[model samples]
Target chain A: MERIPILKMGKFLIVSIQVDMHDELALALQEDLAEQIVKTRAKGVLIDISSLNLVDSFTARILGNMTAMARLLDAETLVVGMRPAVAMTLVELGVSLRGIRTAGNAEKGMALLEAIVAQQAKSNAPKST
Target chain B: MPPKVRDTFTVRSDHDVVTVRQKARQLATELGFSLVNQTKLVTAVSELARNMVVWGGGGTVRMEIVKNGALQGVRLTFEDHGRGIPDIEQAMKDGYSGGSGLGLGLGGAKRLVDEFDIVSRVGKGTRVTITRWK
Candidate 1:
């Protein structure tokens, strides 16, 4: 079965969506990512969607669901490379992905993940008296 | 006289939704629309195509390239003979989705296009037409 590749970088996972996925594929990806996060104990997830030019409501909902699921596993999801047009359409469609983080590109998204993970470490670390 | 160009594609499943979006984008690009306009049009097509499959139980998408004097545009019509909408006005509202959706299907598509029209009957079928000018 064809699947979206999920690469692990230290404590984060990178998923770049290159195809205009069908609903089944999107759902599969969500499930796979969640399982990976738990198995690998990842701290953050970065999803690159720069190649995806079209995102319908179903796609939008699935992305949102994936982000929420990641959060439940103690991992942050930052979606990067959203085209300007896609942003406009998402807002118009009323699918405000409020909980998910976003960035302009991979470089920026990586920075965001690093900061978030670092913050989590700080907050989670035992306090020194 | 304006050019008359029309094409039809089937929408049977989620995969077909992507096909329709691709066709819509190609038509919009060929029509010399801006990237933003092309994206908006394609997104609208995506929403309608999904509705046809999920709600209308599969249908056909008709694409037409139209020109009115100096203005050129792409017109899309989605027709399905499945469960038709009972109240179009309610369905057109921003948050009135009958299915498990954001309820932006009809209204959002309308906002993205320059012209929108829809007709449906309770037991017969439904047809939605939308157009965006370049």
Candidate 2:
């Protein structure tokens, strides 16, 4: 079976969707990411979708579900690198992708992730006294 | 006027849905569709093709380059012999899904295309045709 690779980078997990994925593959990724999040105790997930030319309703739903699942697992997910055309189509298609953070590319996404992790760390830090 | 070209693909599995989307993009690109138009058409194809495989129990898709005077467009027809939809109006509503989906496939696909038509019979089959003109 084919699978999308997930790389663990320090406190974050990076998943670059470089191929046009079928429904099963997308679902598999969602499941795998959830498990990986718990196992790696990652703080954030960055999914790069710049290579995907299309994102239909089903794919959009899976992505949304992944975000929600990550939230449940104590992690934040940032979907990055959506092409302009895809963004236009997704909006017209009536999928708001609510609750999923997005960025223009991986650099911006990673920066955003680092900020989120830092904020989390600051809140989690013990009292200085 | 140039001769019209038509192609057909089977939609039996998830992989087939991806293939259909790729083909739609290729054909749209070949017909000089704008980048946005191509993406819209391919996205629409992905929704409709997945519908056939999931709800329609697998079917076939027909692609053709159509012309209306000065306008050239790509038309796709998705047909399935699975259990047909009982209420198209309900099905077209956003957030109304029969399965584990976002229930945006039919309605979303319609918004992405220039023309849309659907026909179905309970316990018979369903056919959806969509077109995007450049």
Candidate 3:
């Protein structure tokens, strides 16, 4: 699966997931996602996996790679709306999601991104005397 | 003809995934799982099927449905006698992935299913079981 580029919304970007067939779209999206990571200078990313059903080890690896790539671009990645069984199956495949932020749904994921961005901006901005 | 009630199908292959997927959906439907459950299970099976074809080179995939059992769901078992993972821990970690698939890796596969389990030996084989319930 090629990387799937993310869709931007303010400081947050949402990446669409093919879910069933991830190769062509997923990989292609990654280049776009990498580009966004740098261009947007966005605080965070929300990968919407709601449309996907099956993700092979290769697909899973790309996801990890994309997230790592995102981090290098100074953007945090959050994987959202993963079905319970998919989560379990991934575990058996010997993969875990430790660093990446996880959200149950897109709305909440976007919210989390907004909060993080707000906090970062607040900390960076000098306080008025 | 339709498969018998609560039937199980097991196959070994190195160049087929569509067949497994079709079989998985058929059983998932016969078992009477919700759309959510069916999608998850089908997706989960797809991951395992791909793994069996790729990493394992060739392996076995078993599909079973537990209609009246304690779980009342569907189960898939994928096992392969391929080169087992060297660093199971790191492999399972979120950021670490070895295959050419998705960055999500095994972690992503788990997220699509309901219940998942695995046991692997250095060279013996890797057995992964995933189940989706009502």
What TM-score against the true fold does each predicted structure earn? 0.95, 0.97, 0.59
* Residue B37 error, candidate 3, Å: 6.8
Going through the candidates in order, the fraction of native interface contacts each one reproduces equals: 0.81, 0.90, 0.40
Pairs in steric clash, model 2: none
Instruction: Go through the candidates in order and give each one's DockQ.
Output: 0.74, 0.86, 0.20
Where model 3 places Cα greater than 4 Å from the true spot, the runs are A1-5, A55-59, A88-94, A126-129, B1-19, B33-44, B55-134
Q: Model 3, DockQ value?
A: 0.20
DockQ of 1: 0.74
Candidate 2 local lDDT, B10-97, one digit each (tens): 8999999988899988888888899999999998898888889988999999998988988889989999999999999999999888
Error of 3 at B31 (Å): 2.9
How many backbone clashes can be found in candidate 3? 56
lDDT of each: 0.89, 0.92, 0.68
Q: Rank the candidates by DockQ, best first.
A: 2, 1, 3
